[model samples]
Target: MSTPALTLHGVGKRFGDVQALHDVDVTVESGTVHCILGENGAGKSTLCNLVFGGYPPDTGRIALGGKDFRPDSPAAAMAAGVAMVHQHFSLVTTMTVAENLLLTQHGLRLRRQDLTDRLDEIAQTYRLRVDLDQQVATMPVGARQKVEIVKALLRDPSLILLDEPTGVLDPAEIDALIDTCRAIAADGKAVVLVTHKLGEVARVADAATVLRRGTVAGGGRMSTTSIAQLLTAMVGRTAADLDPTVAATIGLDPADAVTHRVGAAPTSISGPDAAEPRSITTSKTSVPMGETGSTASALTRAPIVEHGAESVAPRVDNESGSAAAVLTVDRVTVHRADGSTALNDARLVVYPGEIVGIAGVEGNGQSELVAVLAGDTPVSGGTVTLADTDITTANPATRTGLGIGIVPEDRHRDAMVAEMTLAENLFLGRLGRFRRFGLLDKQAMGRAAKAELDRFDVRAAGPWVPMGSLSGGNQQKVVLARELSAANLRCLVAAQPTRGLDIGAVDFVLTQLRRAATAGCGVLVVSSEVPELLALCDRVFVAYRGALAGPVETSDPAAAQQISELMMGVAA
Candidate 1:
């Protein structure tokens, strides 16, 4: 009898206070896609690390090809026919795609031309497209992901592990990735898909393994298992707890109501791929896993209505000619990477005491709008007024000074200085308040920062710890601590504020944003999560190619459906 591609026997791991993984058992069949589902810290990475020689389990054992597989290092794992594409790319930014692919080769030296040609052949076979000569740093996220996958495939490994493969990809890119995965599986390789999304499990998983709090909850064929059962395992909560109102009755925040899930979970195990996991392509695609698919189809296929600006942009700030709106963007047109208009005549008015959402699929110019409004991007043609102050041409510092705070989409890029201490980060933009008579007042800043950090429930060693030391949720809280605590904060623009946050942090952030809104701060939330918009926004505007659609009332029952339609460019 042939051995399973991989096997775990009562695997357990520990790191001082935390048991990262415990009594975990898994079996992956060759030529099949096996999905390992879990919450953020549910030991998914720990389990993968164990298999990849990142670390060894304290108890039990792992076997590859029915043999004891205790790898000494990641290199040893790769040497033993295993390759992994981690959530974070490990490519050398200075090198070209062809160069990065061949860097790890031991003695098999090939000319540059030969290497490029080989890469091209592999890319063509897998339907993965990447520039051969372009530097890895120059590639977009989706393109870079393709390069990583192709590089892994170049090795022709028997076992491939993808860790959150589609975290940064757009929808079309996601579809392409899913197809690529299917193609790889078709080649009879064993694939371990680690993700938090059930939709991906529903669509492409041949087998599903649920991990809850460091242990295997259950396992079954995708055709036989249910999302409810899977979500229950990962979250330690039932499907009924997913509904905000239902959970609210039990005293839970909307964000906390759902466990690690971003959107909602599928009621049953059904979608595009409900059959036994088979090659999606000759239709192979890949994504990290499901981005969670409760609203996946609706969001991707949401009707897109392309009407003139006169149709969508009908709201006036005030009929009496008063500056009633706290934040007003009129006829904003921001450019794209290709120098096309990303925000074409986009108009909106975010008044005090209202939480407004900009909802759409990823990359419909939400980043451009955030940049332009945050004063990071120059407006090509538009007038942005903040409390009647025309700051259209103002720089970021100037706008920030005028009471506009931004929680950018990519927090590592726009929000915090990773190397700086938590206290230093907390008082980053507003250091003057901490300044003493003749020099920097470190004492005052530390005291104030510590106070706020505790108040915000940021789990940190201390204010002296660098911002990078904290987890995603804690880091986000620190960012929020800085922005929301600003004395003159009037208008807040948050772009995907909860993208990678855990449930608790998400709850805190959402609650704070709502609190800010209640305090009469004009808040603009730009997110791709339909449920988030519907849950928090008083009114939601769907963005399509820089065009802002209806100010759909959240009170309206069809708000989510309408927003989804607008995201897909449908006239509702």
Candidate 2:
């Protein structure tokens, strides 16, 4: 038999007190896509980094083509025919695609024209086309991903590792990426895909390895191993043991018989006065999460059907227009620095005790709308009102003071300072509240932080630990804890709150939003995941070409089709 492209036997790694990877074993053969399946902080990324020479394994061995392999640096790994594309892109946003590609080449001097020609050839060969001269910042998420792939391809490596590459991609883009992966593997090169997305694995992977708590759980050929088996290994729980909502969210089989309680209202996860638990068999034809079609329809079907003596219905009359709105955006229009309208006459209202969702493909004015709502961008034409108080020109602090909480899309950049302690991050913008006289009351802040962390179920060493030390899920928990725990919070505008979270974390976030709504707080969620919106929101609106379309009721049988058409700008 031909030697495997790569192998890791008894590999282990550690960072500080955390054992990131332990006793892990994996093998990738040429001409195959090998998937690394795990939840966040399950050592998927750490395993890839070990192979890419980002860090040396604390123990055991890695072999390339049946030969012992050890590299001191990423450059050495590249020289040995290994390339990696990180979850967070490393491209220079200020530079053009061609310029970024050129930076990856090793030389004292090189011809830019030659590099451009080579890039064009590779693009044509792989069918991953992108404008060579377009600035990285100006390109869409899909285009930027293609650039990263092309950069990795340029190395002509024996093995290429992609870490959570579809976190931000739309459906079409995800399909395209799957095709690209097949093409790469067809060329007799090994592909290692590190992701928690089970659907992607089912579509593109030839074999998969499951990791849980930094140890090898299970793995096998895709044809023989069921997705349920893989999921069981990853989470250490069978599909039957999971809540039906969570099981569906993480792409379990539609036929799985699972039961969960329904609250007094269809809009909430569970009402504050919810009755005894009930069992209901879901539809056999229900669309699973991460599937390519009609997820909104699948999730919304029979959402609140009458069961015997219990009749689940809407308790909160948000659409009646009787209760005062917590947030109102009226004819909001925002222009980019280049004089182009980023948000065009967008208008929406979030009533107290309601959860509203904004859904669309990325770059369809969602970011601009979020910025406008966060008071980061000034609206060219609009009036934003909070509880009858007009605050169109209010700054971020003023908005926060007026009971508007924001959770930005890019958490690391816009939300929290990673280098700071968890305590500091919890009280980031509201340091004054924790101040004792003229000095900062760090002790009080730490105590409050600890309480919040425990309340939010954020798993971490301590409040004194750096915020960056926690996993993506834990970090998000901190952010949510901070925003939701605000004493004066009346409205929460969260953009992609569960963008990179695992299935468990997604459940937690959705539950938190529902609880907030139950407590009379208006919630606005912006997300690219249509199913998530349908599953959690009372009503969903699509953002299309800087315009708003449809307050489609989640219970509408045709809601998914309507949202899809609106997203494509085809709705009349």
Candidate 3:
């Protein structure tokens, strides 16, 4: 097949005591799309880093087109005809999209008009339309991803590495990306897509390689392997042999139903099947604790829903009660930086002991909605009330004071200070708790941080290490630990809480949210992954152009499908 584009033999990597990758081997042929699949922290990023020259491998060699290739840095990697689009965005939020696009291509001063024209052409060619002149900070999550992909394509590299590039894209956008990769391959370039989503791999990949704990466990043409086979190779287990206890604890039940609808209004939580034992009572406090404050480590046992169970039909709330809505949004509108509107007349309400889910395409103003709820952005026009208090104009700190918790979509950037030690970052919003006569109480903060780390079962070298030193999954736990610590939290706003987390971490986070809802805390969850929203939310709201569509019962798959269509702007 005309000399493989890239190859690795016995590649290994280590960071201090952590063996990130070990004895891995992989090969990519010319002009083909190769997909590498693995769970979070299964050494996928480590392998990519090694190939891109982020660091030298502890052992082994890399060859490009039958020649030895050792890139010392990302620049060198690009110079060797390799370009990569990272899963985590690295754009200058303050810069214009045109300016970011021009950053990669050199030799010509970027004129505003000229840059715009070029970006327009590129976007049209790839079906990735975006406002070239808009500030990235004001654009939606999907638009930012377009910028990243455009940046990589501008380089015209012979080999491209895309890391979970579709995590934030809509179905249409995903199709466009897959088409773009295929077009790249048609041009005789090699594409390596590293992702955890098996469905995407099955659709777009020509060949598949499964990685497990730092080694390539299986490799074959995509046509020869089924999704189940790929998954078995990735996790080293057969579907039938998967233990229910492990699946339940790690959040990997094969039968777990996801509740995302595409084109209809949000589904209701009421139906005969809705009475299932997911959560028996809405107000559940009195969480059981272990001796070491490590609740997560002791969660290996099967979960049991013990409170009063209801039927699966949607809950019809027509009450005129006086209990304050923990969160309230009135006629809010979100505008794009380029004068386009994202959401119009969008309203939201969250009461105690309730979980409200916002389901839609990746963009559709979900990120902005979360920001508005968290008080990070000013609503264009609307009133927001928290615990019967008007918090529409309040800042982040004020919202926090009103017992609001936020797990932002971008956990590494907006949620955690990665450069700081774990303990220091954990104590960030809890300054009052570590203060003693105006002095910082280091011991108290450490004790508190230790408790959270144990409770979340965050695996790291040590609590004293920088937060960035841990894996992606553990980094998410840090954000969750801090957000869920508000002693009297009336509401929680979690955006894509399990985006990059592993099964174990996903289970822990979902369980915590359920527990919070049971404890009279209203929770608002926004996610692109429908299954997650289905499993955790009490009711689902499909947002389209900033409007809430449904409030539909998830028990009926037909109704759920209708809602899914509505979410994607599809007509029934």
TM-score of each: 0.76, 0.89, 0.75
Select the stronger candidate by TM-score from 1 and 2: 2
Top of the candidates by lDDT? 2
Please give the CA lDDT of all the candidate structures. 0.72, 0.79, 0.69
Candidates ranked by TM-score, best first?
A: 2, 1, 3
Show where candidate 2 strays beyond 4 Å: 108-117, 238-280, 283-297, 300-317
lDDT of 2 by residue, 1-572 (tens): 99999999999999888899999999999999999988888999989989999989999999998999988889999999999999989999999987888886575254787766777777676777768789999999888999999988887899999999988887778878888999889889999998766767767889999898999887777766656566656765543443334544553333321221111112211324222223335543343223354243244322433323433343353673879989998999989999988899998989998888999888879899888888889999989999888889989888888898899999989989899999999987888888787999888888888899988889998899999988888999999998898888999999998877786686677667766776789999998877667666778899988988888887766666777778777786
lDDT, residue 462, candidate 1: 87
Residue-wise C-alpha lDDT for candidate 1, range 1-572, written one tens digit per residue:
67799999999999997898888889998988999877566788788889999988899989998989999899899989898999888988998877786776664476677767777777676677777789987677888888888877777789999987865665556668778878778888999988655555656788889887798886677656655556556654453323231222112222322332223342343444232211110111111213333331111111111222211111222222343888999999888667877889899998876788898776677788898988888888979999979999998888888899999988998899999999988888677887778688888888898899987889887899888867776898888888898888999999888765544455467667766775778889987665566656668898887788888876665565566667777665
Which stretches of model 3 miss by more than 4 angstroms?
89-106, 109-144, 154-156, 217-219, 224-226, 232-325, 332-343, 379-382, 387-390, 393-395, 436-438, 568-572
Clashes of each: 21, 0, 39
RMSD of each: 9.3, 6.5, 10.2
Candidate 2 has a TM-score of 0.89
Relative to the true structure, candidate 1 reaches a TM of: 0.76
Which stretches of model 1 miss by more than 4 angstroms? Answer: 10-19, 55-59, 92-96, 102-127, 131-138, 210-225, 239-323, 334-344, 360-364, 395-398, 432-451, 534-572
Q: Residue 284, candidate 2: how far off, in angstroms?
A: 8.9
